[model samples]
Target: MAVSNVPKYHIAMFPWFAMGHMTPLLHLANEIAKRGHTITYFMPRKAQLKLQHLNLYPDLITFHTITIPHIDGLPPGTEIATEIPISLCPLLVETSDLTQDQIELAFRANKPNFVVHDNAHWMPRLAKQLGIKSICYDVVSAATLALVFVPGRNFPKDRPITEEDLSQLPPGYPSSKVVFRGHEIRPLMMITMPMGKNITFYERMVKAKKDSDAIAIRTCEELEGKLCEYMVAQYKKPVLFTGPVLSAEDMKTPLEDRWDKWLGGLNPGSVVYCSFGSEFILEKDQFEELVFGFEVTGLPFLIALKTPRGCATIEEALPEGFEERVKGRGVVYGGWVQQPLILKHPSVGCFVSHCGASSMWESLMSDCQIVLVPQLIDQVLNTRQLAEELEVAVEVKREENGWFTKESLSNAIKSVMDSDSEVGVKVKNNHAKWKEILGKPEFMSGYADRFVQNLHDLVK
Candidate 1:
């Protein structure tokens, strides 16, 4: 790097240890580095290994490895949240909290002008102590944050928060279309519950928002204008967006040969590809029903998900006679495959996803018709953004028990895949409209440039 093009300012970032959180922060880092700014990324040693490929500008961006401190219940090398059960996530948070001193040392050495992070609310306090500004960046959808976690949204402390409370829209919340239902609200119940050393998830997020100099999310005002406004008013701080920080040109690696050969053999826009992102393990009955649902669709399909409980592999969890019926046409893969590439494949026409924030952006940028089956709270909110607000996707109808029937799953797929279906035509048209706007280089890059400028102004 020449002195003439030297980085404008130094910034450091550390998101939660989960790949879901870390990957988005890294994507944002990549965009910032593109504008001749330096970055020091702090993440778990293992996540760095898995995600180093995303560091497109190594000359401008650097990775500093972090090893999670050992805790009693965690295994010898438990470094990330995805490797363990959800119940054990609190332990991971506790371990991450133990690293305040470690991060402070990095701060002292690197001397970043701004510290960008999530989960580590302590980052704000630490940054202030060292004369660095703190930027709290959220990778989750804007709608989710506005509806669920905005200030003044917490239930009264006198009584416990019920499912009813979770289902109700927050006062002055931007949308009623994204409400949680039935057992789907169970995940939100733990938001305020104490985890490590009595620090609740709700409290951490509140502090991160309140204490930071500014807040940022990976979405722009065009798609979520009202929600962004709500954030500014609620938090009473500067809010910024990076406009879906993903680029197809950045991921140069071609899809692996085996997947290429299989998908290539199918007709264009004929295959239904399904993945729930990392860390979701479906229960036994839901897993079997989900695969059975695809079988009923009678479409060429690929499902990338974990084996259900009591099963060692996807093969063992298969219902009897399942293999014989769908051997050539359907694949139940239990391992990680390159998701972004697979969605871009020509043969993949319909994507059945868990409506994760990353998946939502990827699916929108692709030409595929979208189908959502959201499991977590953020996912549920993301589903509404696409299926209800934007009208570019259809969420599979679930029963009152929070489980979808195979028929419902099959119906949603057929509705989107069938050319004559009304629902299919509407989503396809809406999805194509979004795909065009998001794929434009100038639109996405412009947001990134302005975001950096905003930070620059903060320091100046």
Candidate 2:
């Protein structure tokens, strides 16, 4: 742990072109940089802009931008996956692959000691050709990784995963009997590449695992101990847990921000903060149901929704008179907000979230109890961890056919926020316990040091 004793490495970082993926890599990069390792963070030009607000080490970390190649059917200016529809993600992957040459040139110039990459499946091969160590970094829950790597899943290459397939526990997974419903699996199946390519998402994941020197995941042993053990045994490789990587700065509220001013006026733990991450574009009906659900709760709330592409305004997408009816108690913003600051606010009691890993960690690091309403890939799996395994959240009830109604959403919110309810009290207590653990600087710093030490061993 001594600064002089620790080896200083030149590490290259490449993350999948998504905010969820990039943000965690940034956290890891900062952690590594603090250890005196030099880092070359590679990302698309537009994607690099997202990190401008953060305070990163100037001497130890450098940003290397790659020009995204043009691909047909993809929007001209789209550089990240969240900027486009989920259906166009395969095109994004293809276009990103075209940048391999530029990345190679940079790698050759710098000659990094090792490379850390997310689901950009081809990275391992490129690292091998360059004679450097390759580390596969996952930004999702261990259960999702376990399920994806389960023997015989045949994910994207086979016929679409059926309801029956999801209902059964994946073979060879450790004692946890996690089962997915059809609705949960549907979005994952939708993210496939063109058929003839011979490389499905499942294959890509397998290839990354097979080719990497080791794996690093964005979770703690305390959170997913069993799945973490299983991943190591199944892959027969060194698996390092990087803990939650939750920043202490997230606890600070920005001065004079509009949302901060509004939150300041409310009573402590009296507001509900609702947000479905950037990637999930809600259908009109789904959006209406959620709005009605929030209305029924009759609690002070703030909802941040991204306007889908081609949608001119949030008002056009929302129900008529929705804002007027809840004028004093509720506010809706069309685009992004400082989510972590809002989560840490004293007035926020509950977070109705999409269960994205980033949001889950942020909520866990805050005082707010979680109400799960997962929308896309791996989110449902994360919901299982929060609602079932950890007992720190309440999942909205859906019909047998997997349809959730406004009534269900309202009830779910109340079940977590209602002071008189036993479930509500337990969920809040569990969230508090987790927040205490994740907020400890020593705990997070230890994990980050272990992660770097493991990378050092891999390269040696």
In TM-score terms, which candidate is top? 1
Task: Please give each candidate's TM-score.
Answer: 0.96, 0.95
Assess candidate 2 and give its lDDT: 0.81
lDDT of 1 at 281: 85
For candidate 2, list the clashing residue pairs, or say none.
Answer: none
Give the alpha carbon lDDT tens digit for every residue of 349-427 in model 2. 9999989999988878778879988876588888888888778899898766455888999999999888999999998
State candidate 2's TM-score. Answer: 0.95
lDDT of each: 0.87, 0.81
Error of 1 at 392 (Å): 0.9
